[model samples]
Every structure is written in C-alpha cells, then in structure tokens.
Target: MSGTGDDFKWFGEGFDGFPKRLPEDVVEYIIFIINSKLSAIQTRERLQGFQRALATLEKKFLKEYIWQRESIRMDLVCDNRRWFLRGTTNYGDSVADEWLIVYFLRELSQEFPDAWIRIYDTDGEFLLIEAANAIPSWLTPEVAENRVWINNHHLCVIPVSDHDNPKSLAIEEALSIINDVPTKLQHLPKIEQEAFYRLKSFPSAISENQHHATLPIPRKLAYILRSNPSYIAPAVEAFYLRDPISLRLLQPEKSRTQLNFPPESFVSVSVRFTKVLYAQLLGQQWVPPGPYGEALAKLISKESGVPSVSREKAEIGIKVTAGFEMLAQHKLYADKKATREIQLLLEDIEAGDEALPSDDEIARWPKREDNEGWLDIDFVEFEKELAGKGAGSTTRGFGDKNAQDNLRKMVERFNKFIEDEDAGLDGAKGLGLDPMDIDNDSEAPPVGWEDPEDSDDSDDNEDDDEQADKEFEEYERTFEKFLTLSSAEKSALLDDARELAQVEEAEKEEDEEIKKLSEMMEAELFSHGALNLGAKKNSGVKPVMGDGEGRGKAKLEEFLEEVDDNDVEYLDEDYNLAENMLQAFKGQAGMAGPAGNLMSMMGICFPPDADTDEEFKNKNKDPVNNK
Candidate 1:
C-alpha cells in the first residue's frame, strides 16, 4: 500500500477498498474534497493536475475521485438461487449515497423478477428505520441488524446467527420465516411503496455534471438547495409525497374567516403553473430532460399567459401544490379518525352496557288494541335515565300504546275536561285576575237571616258547598299575602316568574317548529305519490277530439234547449239585417260617381245617381278642368 500508483494495491478496481491506513482527519479531508470539488466533471478536469500530484503522494485520493462519478457503489454476488446485491457508502459517507442505492435496488428488482434479489447496505438497514412501526413484530433490532434486505421489492428481515457463515444461510433463514408467515414483513408498506413509485424517476446519476433544472419549490428552499445539491433528490421525493407535516413546514396559516381577506386575495400574484398543480402531478403528460422541465413550465406559462418562469412564480406553484397535498392529507387523517371512532363504537356495543334494555324486555311489552292513540312514552323520565348514563352512550328502547277505541275516548275526555273549569279558575290569581269577581257580584245575605234546610238529607250538600267556600277563602288569602309583599320584593318575584314564562314560551316555540318540520317532511314523503304514473285518475282539461269529445256535449245541448223560440227568431232577424247593411256598404265602395264618393266619405252607402255621373264626366272633359 505505497503512495506510488502501481504499488497502491489496497485501492482496488471500482474503489472497493478504502484508505484504512490513513489518519482519520486526512481521510475526512479527502472525503470533503471528493464530495465538494470532484462532484462535477468540469471541476474534476480542472483539478486533474492537483489530483495526480495528490494521488502520487497518497493514492487513496484517486480512488475517492473516481467513486464520485458512479451512481451506485455496490458489489453483486450469487450463490445458488439467491442473488446478493451489497452496497456501501461512497467516500466513507453512507448518508450521501443511501437513497440512490435504495432506488437502484428497486429498479434492479423490477428488472430481475424471478431472482431472489437480497439487497442491503453494509452501513445500515434499508428502509427499516422509516418503516419500523409498519414492519412485523418479529423484526426486532437484534434480529434485523446486518440481516435486513429488500427482497423481491419487499422488506425481508433475514436473521443470521453468525456473520462468519456463508450468505446462503441467511437466504435459507428468510425462506423459513416466509414459510411460517408468508405475508409478514415481506411486503413494502403502502405509504412507503407509494413514495418509491413517485420518486422512481429521479436522476440516478449522482454528479454535478448533469444539470438538474429547478423544481417548483419555495425560493428559500431553492436557495438552500443551491448550496447543498445532495438534498435535492430527497426534497423532490418529499414534495411528491406531500405529507401534511412536510408541506406545512414553511407555510403560513390562512385567515380564511377574516372579513378583510377576500377570496380573490388567494389569486396568484405571479405566473404559477396552477393548472397542472395536482396531488401527485396527476394531469401532466410532461417528461424530463432536453426540455428538462420544459413541458410543465411551458404548460403553466401558457395557462397564465406569462412567457417566462421566475423563482417567485415557481414558489407560488409550489405553495398551491402544497395546498392540494395538505387537503389530501387532511382527508386521509379524517377518514382514519372516523374509522377509529367507529371501531371504538362497535367495541362498546359488543361489550354491552347495563343501562340499555335487553331484547327480551322489549319483546315482553304489551301491544296496542287500536291505533291512533298517544304512545305511553314518558319522555321526561327517559331523558333523566339518559342523563344518568352520560352523553357518551346511547341505546334502543320500546313504547306501548294500549288505549282502545282512542278517538271516541279522546272526544269524551275533551268534553269532561271542558266541563270541569276548576283547573282554569285556580290559575286566575297567577294571571292577575280575581276569581271572586268572575264568580259573583250579588250583595251578601243579612247576618241574622239563615235559610232553613228543606230536609236532613240536604245537610251533606250544604257541607260540601261550605268546604268549597273554605278552599276559595284559603286561595284568596294566599293571593292577598302575595300582594302585601314590598314593591321591590314583588318586582323581583315578577321578574323571576317572567323568566320562567319566557323559558316555557321558548320551549313551546321550539316544540312547534320541530313539529311543523316533521309534518312538512311527512308531506314531502307523500307528495311524490302525486307525480307517479296514473296517480291522477282524470285530467280536468276536456279532450279536443276523440271518444271523450262528447263527454261535455250534453251540457252544451241542454243549455241550447233551454233558450226561448222567440229569442232564436229575433237573433235570426238581426243577423239578416246586419248582412243587408254589410252588402250595401260593399256596393257603395264599387260606385264611381261624385254622389257615390260623397256617400262613401260620409260612411253611408247609396245607389249611384245617373245625372251625377254624366255631370261629373262633362265637367272633367273640359281642357282647363283636365289640366
């Protein structure tokens, strides 16, 4: 491992071996030079003389320089049916080239379908960190350490008991695990798979020689990426995925409900490729290179009528695209939340709550003998029970309607209710109306004049009247006590009463509205029947002609028959007179004499006079008159 090019045996072909003998700081400095300076072909060419001198001094520098141009740094080996594609980081830094290797392995799996392609990085497990939660339970860190690989486009956790053993044992272990649980850990997670599919077309070559056109990204991000182009690949993939958390990183919260923030304010201030802004760029037919980003850029430019693309326009498009992505992510989160809530609800139902009535209890309830009766449902009691159970629970229950011949019984009850007016009288004091004023206005009897009972049997009737009078006196006393309260106390009590009344009034109004809504809904449900075919038995409009033409002819004939004969004769005479007058008027129009013209001017028709016609012709024949 001498400094001379020919003697540097440790620097193998394809830069497989590293400069292990070199000091750590020197190796790090060489890595930095390779990543920063040798990334582009032009830079490499310009530094060729310096690299040659450095290579002659320390040959490991040349190996690092050559490694920069290659896209994927990997070694391939095969044992029986298992194909091992081993990858390692270029220039001792795995972070710089891990994604490129992962993407290349995916492309390789698609290319070699039948082969058991087991791909892994020597430095770290592939995709295991990203999909740790999604992977199977058995894929523990210990089991997966140095054993995890992507097989057949799926994450396969193959445990190896000893690293010293051949690679075939690891393949056998994978096969055994697959046999036990075929679907476990051997499939890429849905979200991760989608991400790979979207980012599959990223430029595979890791070099600054190939210029990558700017993506529709934020200006700040663009600026950041200009310095660190290595971040571009991951950034593009993240943009495609449009995860809400990622999208919202630099976006400001929108004040959508603000009065001053009009809807038109959201209109792009510059040319943005908004028409093609979709979740996953679904509408674009554009591809990359020569016109690298030309198709999308041109389409967006044409849509906005702005001929050129600028960083501001690109930033706008990126912002809107992030909005679309955010909307999708929100919907996904909502759907997941709804699914979880429904699952919990189902579990609660299965667990069963004691407050709910059982099926047997509902079945044992009595049936109604007749319909059209008020259901025996104590809603107040039901509400109390529901409140006791808490808002988080609900249940099904039953009702009984056992009133027989309800309509007739309801009429009788109404009559009895109206006859017993004592209930109305009891509320008179509360209504600020004196009950005694409504009962009677006659003067009281003299103190010594007592009416003698007609018989002993009448004493009970008197006693009952006395009891009624005593009750009325007690009610009057209560009313007087209420009036004796101070004005302030009375006002306070009145206000309290008014509030209660207002509450009751509001409740009544609400109940009425609900009842009216229910009735309208019921009407709407039945209204559709009117629109059904043949629902209307007869159309009111009479037929113009057909078998139904004579349907109303009888009424016309009867009306004609009811007319007098004299009236018909008079109608005929009037018609003849009118015909004669019309003929005279027409004849007058045909007359050609002066008398006829005079009659026509007067609107009176006359027979042409022979003398007048000769007189007119003679007068017109004179030369002076003709001129």
Candidate 2:
C-alpha cells in the first residue's frame, strides 16, 4: 500500500498539466517533495512541473528567462533524439534538459577536448541506469577522488571538507567536475554529460518556486559571475575545461600575505646618472690633459725660440685644441729643470759651496742656455779667410804660378841632399870604415852640399877648407878631451847635453806630430767611403789629441801639479836618490846600476794615483788595508 501511494504521488499527480504553469504553492510543494524523496520518478515529475512554471514565467520575464529557456532547449534537443527516451514518461521524454547539457558540452569541448563529466546515484554509487545513454559509469571514476558528490546523490553530500555545502556546486563547479575527469574521456560530450550528471546526481529542478530551497552558489564562482556578467556559465565552463584544478584554485585567498614596502624609484635614477657620467668620462669629454705638455713646450720655446711649424702648433694651436698636451710639456720641462738643479746641488756640496738652488726654485726658473760661449779664434779666422777666397780658388789650386815654381826648386834641393848622404856613406865604407861603426857615432852627420864640377872647385875649396881645418882641429881637440875620460864620465857629460837637446826637440816634434795627425785624421774622416768620426761642432767641445811620446809630457806635468804634496815629496826623494846614483856611476868608472832599475823606482814613487781627499793623505796606500 505504501509503494502504491508513493507511485501514485510520483506518476499520477506529480507532472499533471505538465506543459501548463503550476500554481506557485503547488510548484513549491512539489519542489519540497522532490527534495525529500529518493525515488527517480518523483524527482523527474517535480522537475517537469518546475519546467512548466519556468515556461509560463518566460514571457513575463523574457530577458531573465532567456538563459534558463536556452539551457532547457539544449537539454531537450540531446534527450529527444536518444532511442531509450522514445516513449518514456512525459518529464523523461522532455529533451530540454538534455539539450541544455549538450550545449554546455559543446562549449567545454571547444576549449579542452580532454575534459569529461560524471554522475552519481542518490547513494553516491555509479548511477549507470539513470544516465545510461548520456554518460557511462566508466567516466565517473576518473574524478571520484575530487568529486562534487560523495556518499549519496542527496544535496547534503559534499566531496572536499571545505566545500561541504551543496550550495557550492554552482555552474563553475559543475564545469569543474567535467574538466577533472580522465583526459582519455575528455573527447566525449563532456558538458552535456556534466549537466546530465548534475541533474541526475542532485535530481532537483531550479525554478522560482524552489528558489529558496536551491543550493547557494559557491562564493568564488558567484563573485566571478558578478564581476564578469557578460560571460555565461558555458563560457566560464570553457576556462575550467583546459585546467580544472588550477582554474578553481585561482580564487583569491582571504588571508593573503603580500609585501607592502614602497618601491625605491631613486635607485634607477642614480644608476642612470652614474652611467651617463661614466660614459662622458670614458669618451674623454670631461677629463682634460694634464699640465706637463704645455710646460715642456714653453720651456723649449724659451730656451730655443727657433720658429718651426710644429713648435708653433704645439705652443699655440695645441693649447687651443688639445690644451692638456701643453700642460704635459710644462710638467716635462719642470722635471728636467729639477733634475739638473739636483745634480748641480750635489756638485756644489762636493765642492764645499753652501749656496745652492733648491729643487722647487729650480723647477720654477726659466729655461737657460746650455752652451757657454767659448769661441776658437783661429778656427774663426780660418773660416773667414776661406769665405774671402772665391770657391774655385779655395780648392787645391796651383797657388800663384811663381809659388809653385819655388816649391819645385825646394823639392829638388831636398832630393839632392838625400843622394849626397848616400854617396858619403858609400865612400866611408870604401875607406875601410865599417857601415855599422857609423851608427856608433854620438853626433849625426852634417848636411852635405851638391857641386856641379867637383874637380875644378877642389883647389879653391881646398884653400877655403885649409882655414876651416885649423878651426875644426881645435874643436876636435876639445871634443876628444871628453872622449878620453872613462865611459861613465863621458856618458854623464853626453846625458847633460842630450837632456837639453831632447827638451827642445820634444817640443818641436810634439807640435809637428799633432798637426800632421790632425790633418791626416780630418782628411780620412771627412773623405767619402770613410766614417765621419768628428766631434759635433754644436757640442762646443774640442777633439782630444792622441797621446805621443813627447806630447804625453804635458799631461804628466798637469798631473804632477794636481798631485798632493805628499806624493810630490815621495817622487822628489826617489828622483834625488836616482840622481845621486847616476853621479856615483860617473865618479866610479863602469860601476853604474841598471838605468832601468832607477826608472822602476821613480815609477813607483810617481804613481798615477790622484789624491781625492781634501787633506794630503796617503793616496797610494794599499787597497787591502790602508793604514
């Protein structure tokens, strides 16, 4: 009887006057019965009544009913064409709910083909029979873990702890359930299956009569719909189709921990300014050249103002264009001046002079001339004489024809004298005088004269020679007196005369050798194909003459003058001893020591050591231990 009453209430009066509008009270009471009942027929009949009421209100609230009507129309289109629903109960036969599900599926499939849907029975088991043609049980398990429904199809069931309210299952949540299914089932009619599952699983109609009894929309989804009202539920469902969990998780968190510190705008400004300054400096726009360049140029100009193009540009134009070059030149000049002053100061200190310029003062002073005026008058006169003569005449010319004639005569005379000496030596040899014996003679031979007719002049020359013979005899007697003495005495007398002769001969020979060598070297050096080895005239220094036997004596005299008193005394003592020994050799015949020995002792006494000390200290002290 209870079963009959339940069936009668479900099939007989539930969907009575189905296509027409139900009374508001009847619709509300029907929604209440649908919510309380577990039977599919009762739920279906109540949903049919809600649909009729929605249609009746459609014309009156056309704009509001457009989305609802369109949803119903899409569901009907899908359900009516199915074979299983050909002759079902009136609400079961209605295809509006199915068509609405198909519409949502089409929208979800466009965005994400991998999306799917699931349906659950009132007991939360796979509702295979109820959704047999629309969605299979196999698609439901894919999202069984993150499902919207739990133990039962009742609206009281919720999957996640946080989403316990059935009101949370809004259009977005329904779309999410479809998207969360396995990717393999996404190509199925996901949106249609999702809508079908939502109706079968929840089994409640959304109508004005049951408006108060309907589950509340999820706060997140409701906010989204309110914010983006232009987008319909199917459009929002499309977003979830691609990524269900992530899209749902995008809901704003209530307890967000965002940072609140103000951004530092000055950092970028400071960096930009620093970069600009660095670029300017690197580009050489800001930094100028130092003072050394100009200082050096000024010094050069002051010291030697030879007007030159480069110098003018360095001094004037360079200052205008690249001024630092001039500054660098100035610094260089200052450094040079400072260096020279330091050297001069050292020299002064060595000389015991107290007054000397400081380095700073020297650096500040103007450039001075390096060369001192030391003119060679003879050279100047010679140059003047050369200038006076015409270029051609100055060359090695036959000086005034008469002078050439006189030179030729002089050459002939010199040649005749040489010939006469040869003849005299041959005659002496023929007269039994040994040629070697001639070299033994203390005096050199007198100059011989040439006569054209020696036979005719012999008698006249004999008469003149007779008087000369008497004077010569007397001179021979005097000379023979010194020769008769012991060899020691004779050598002593000869040495006195030789010393006097040597002095005069040395002076003459030194002068002649210097002049000859200078002329020879000058000619060789200046000649083509030879090295131009000559002192630079600009240096204003004379060329040093080569040391010769007699020429070296002057250098010795200078050295002797420069020697300290102690060295002079030592030399004088040794030389006096040598003189005494020489005198003793004269007194005692053939008793002289080696002359070389005396010379060696003199050399030791007159050592080349120069006394550097202010006092006449022992300059010749042994280096190992100077006592």
Cα TM-score of candidate 2: 0.12
Model 1 ranges off by over 4 Å: 1-96, 145-147, 156-172, 175-185, 188-627
Model 2: per-residue lDDT, tens digit, 1-627?
001221123355575422222222110010112132235464455444434544544444333221311232212112322111101111121233333333332333333222222322222223322233334333343233223321111211223333342222332454344335322123334333433343432212222111100111222222222232222222212221323332222222421322111110100000001111112222231211233243334434643232232332233222222211111122232343322443344455458674333335433533322111111123323333334332233343333222233343344444544555434744422233445756666687887886766777888888889989999999988866754577579658877998999999999999999899777644533342123223232332111111332344466456557778778566554344433333332333433233323334555222222222222246545678875
Cα deviation at 97, candidate 1, in Å, is 2.7
Q: Would you estimate the TM-scores of all the predictions?
A: 0.20, 0.12
Indicate which candidate wins on TM-score.
1
lDDT of 2 at 176: 40
Q: Supply the TM-score for candidate 1.
A: 0.20
Mind giving the per-residue lDDT tens digits that candidate 1 earns over 228-336?
A: 3333332223345555354343233431221110111112221111111221243222222222133235435654333345643344344433433233234343343
lDDT of each: 0.38, 0.32
Question: Which prediction has the highest lDDT against the true structure?
Answer: 1
